[model samples]
Target: MIPIYKPYMPQNIGVEISEILYSGQLGFGKYGREFENKLQSFIGAEYVLSVSSYNIAMLIVLSTLGLREGDEVIASPVSCLASNQPFAVKGLRVVWVDVNPATGAMCPDDLKSKITKNTKAIFHNHFCGYLGDIESINAICNSFGIPVVDDGIEAFGSQYKGRKLGNLGTDVTVFSFQTVRLPNTIDGGAIVFKDKDLYEKALLIRDYGIDRTIFRSSNGEINPDCDIEVEGYAGLMSELNSYIGTRQMDDINSLLAVQKNNAAIWNDKFTNLDTINSLKITAGCIPNYWVYGTLCKNKTKTIKDFKEQGYYATGVHINNNIYSVFNNNVSLKGVNEFINHFVAVPCGWWFENK
Candidate 1:
């Protein structure tokens, strides 16, 4: 059966892992630093921090925002719970924003209508590697003195206009390297910061607010005079994951190319199918097409038909506001429309017509 998603693992990954195991230093060390540097260079970001998972990456970014209880954070309702769960855990109120009907990304007009004095940040998800109108959203947020956090987990290799997703001038951008995502590290993620101060703070926060590098003396000897200034967490990526990630980076471009090619194939085939509507890409935005989603007249029937034909198709993520934990029953017209009809089929590099 064709799965909806499959990770791209390189041929030399086992050898890389063996090296990490034999080195006897397996925590956040040289491999992690190397991976961070490579990712920074790849995405053209000023600073990148490797974290254990995408969820932890989001938590770290939200924690650095200096939000207080009852502070509001604007976010799209049509995203995986991971995108908005950080806000709730940080004691920030979630102000739900609708998504674009065509792209399934945060709608800038809806975002504008939701911003208030209490809005501390605006979190936008680049759904299925398709970028939203982030520039316009950033403009509105900037006017209100609010920062934007991009949940770019599914958009690692995507570009909007000419700029990459992570370096699109957002305040903070987080990406995932989970088992099913592109350039999988088994389980890891990264955070990119536009602000140097926040990047430095994140460096400390990933390792319990303690600067481990400061403990090394000029001669590379251990110095026990370091201090811990702020509260932090054990969010650092492991050396094994980083090593795998570094190798995966070598094939990222090719992997994205194949996925995009497969999505184009589906787009062309479904163009004349009156019962299906493919998700539209915005002008000048080149999507990596993590999963090719379609709005079908009968989503349930379409999913069953696809499954029977050896293709695994399903909803990418449930709308966050539908859960009782969020208790948000407000009408998000676009989101409601999307959730009711959307279904995603396999468009990963491993996918093939059977």
Candidate 2:
């Protein structure tokens, strides 16, 4: 059976990994640094700190920002579990909000309604790589003096009004270089902070609250032995992963072109099929389609049809509504619709043809 998603491994990935295995420098080193630099430069962010996963990135971003217990986080309900857990993990209460159905993004109106006096930050995930209404979202949050952390795991290159989605809408934009991400690092993540002070703070938090090896010597000399572990986890990406990430980063433009073309193909091809629910895009927002998704007239039957047709498709994750733990106290009409109708159609590097 066709699966909903699979990791992309270009021709040289094994060679790169093999080289690292042979190098005796297996931990975080030059590879992770290069990944951090290349990624920051690629996204036009001021500074980037590499970490183990987007989950660690989120937690670090929150903890470094000084968000604490009784602090409330406004999060889009129509997001994956990771988006909310960081807040919960840091002892902050999460305020669930809804996303706009068309864009599959945070609704600014709902955001305005949800912001309370104790709200510390707003978190948004770029669901399915569709761009969020980031400018408006940022505007509202900034007016209320709220920090916004973008969960940009799925949207590596999604842009809003010419600016990338993560960069435009939030103070800290977190990305995952996990296998599921656009530029796969196997398992890694980073937090991009546009502000200098915030960037340093995040760096310290990632390294265990200490500050050393902060940069290469002025003469460009490097020293791994000179180090300090602050209040941090060993969440650095491997150089091998970064090497692959660099390779994938270089290929992103071409890859996105093909994925978007495929999205158009799916939209056009499925138009006549009334039983299909094609994914929607926000006007003027360019999305780097990750898992092209839809809802079926019959969710199960639709997936079965796609599978029968050699397409790997399946339902998606939203809130914990179906989960007994959440019991879902909040009303998330749009999120619930996404949860029920959600089915991801493959749009990665995988091939689909007769």
Candidate 3:
């Protein structure tokens, strides 16, 4: 049976990994810097930082935001837990922004209605790698002088308008390189910053808040003068993960092309099916097509039928509000509609070989 998601590993990765394992420089070093540089070039962003995973990437972005307890953040209810859980863990209140059932993305109108003086930032999640109305979301947040944090975990290679998601005027964009994502590095992530100051701050805070530029004297001895300005977490990516990421970057373009081509085929096949309605793609955006999502009248029946035909299918993401940890009870009309019918099927590069 074909599965809905698959991790792509380069055939030559064993040789590359063995080389790094034997080099004795297993920590963040040349390869980590190289991976960050590659990401900067690909995303057309001025500042990029490689981290251990997407969860750590979000924490690093939150560190730069300077948000206090109880500050409200506008975010979609329909997204992976990795996208919104960081806010709750940071003691910030998450104000749910309803999604457009047609697209499975945040509804700009709902966002406009929810903003208030308590709103510190807006977290824009690109659902299933399908682009959202970020232009409108940016315009709304800009009026209030709020920053926008793009949760690009599933949108690593997606292009919005003419630029990539990270470089599209958002204040911060975080990407996931975890297994099953387009460019898997075993498990890793990256952050792209629009502000140079924030980028510098992240550099210091990513590894115990020590200033690497002057932490050691000219003779390689620890400087007694170095002071820890801000306490930080251990979030930097390791040299091993970085080496794998650099290798994966080599084939990113072709990997993306195959997913797009497969999605187009699925789109055509389901177009005339009266029981199935495909999700909509935003205008001027080329999605990475992490999975081919569709809405049906009976999600359970559809999934079972696919399984019987030797294909895996199911609801990929559940609305975060349903969990008790969030403690949210607001009823959202669009979210209700989306949760009822949304289901995903296999649409990765692996299908090409099958």
Compare the candidates by lDDT and give the number of the best one. Answer: 3
**Preferred candidate (TM-score higher): 2 or 3:** 3
Q: Between candidates 1 and 3, which one is better according to lDDT?
A: 3
- Give the C-alpha lDDT of model 1: 0.85
- For 157-258, candidate 3 gives per-residue lDDT tens digits of 899888988999999999999998978888999999999999989988788898988899999999989999875879888999998898888889998899
TM-score, per-candidate, Cα-based = 0.94, 0.88, 0.97
Q: Encode model 2's per-residue lDDT on 1-354: one tens digit a residue.
A: 545567775675676678889999987788777777778777877678878788888878877788777777777767677666666567677677887765567888988998889888888777878767777888998899888888887888888778775566378888877887787778877788868888887777876665655445667765555475446665666667777777777788787777878787788777867777676776678888787877666888887888898878876665643443343467688876666677788887665522
lDDT of each: 0.85, 0.75, 0.88
Pairs in clash, predicted candidate 3: none
Count of clashes, each model? 0, 9, 0
Ranking by lDDT: 3, 1, 2
Which 10 successive residues of model 2 have the least lDDT summed? 319-328
